[model samples]
Target: GKQITHNLKSRASEFIFYALALDESTDMAGTAQLAIFIKGVDVHKIKKKTETLAALYPLKDTTKLQDLLEAVT
Candidate 1:
């Protein structure tokens, strides 16, 4: 438990870029599934930069997901 807790705490402030994919599951269920892939440097300094950017301009859902993905990439 301690190891798990420590790992989670250490990663809490990490900056992660997620590549998301949304699609319908193959089971014929009328539901959608979202897949996320996260990758980033495992360092503390990046967290501070992320915080600064977040403070300056918060994230909003004003644009379509595809447009947002295009802008970020």
Candidate 2:
């Protein structure tokens, strides 16, 4: 978490806007997924950052993900 925060803070200038999309099934055995969209930075960079961050710290809750989005933007 700290590492991710640090990386984001260091590259804060590259980001302009942040948006998060969350989806969850209505069934009891459904699953959830989150998609983060960031503007200003190049799409490739955003993709790389999101992929790396997802691998390092997989977020399970929307609140934590939102917190991260807020921090970066």
Q: What lDDT is reached at residue 24 by model 1?
A: 20
Q: Could you give candidate 1's per-residue lDDT for residues 1-73 as a string of tens digits?
A: 3443353345444655322222222224433222223344445555532221111111233345653443333
**lDDT, each prediction:** 0.34, 0.40
lDDT tens string, model 2, 1-73?
A: 4664565554454554443333322233432333333334444465544321221232354545474454334
The most accurate candidate by TM-score is 2
Runs in model 2 with CA error above 4 Å?
15-37, 41-56, 59-73
Q: TM-score for candidate 2, please give it.
A: 0.28
User: How well does candidate 2 score on lDDT at residue 55?
Assistant: 16
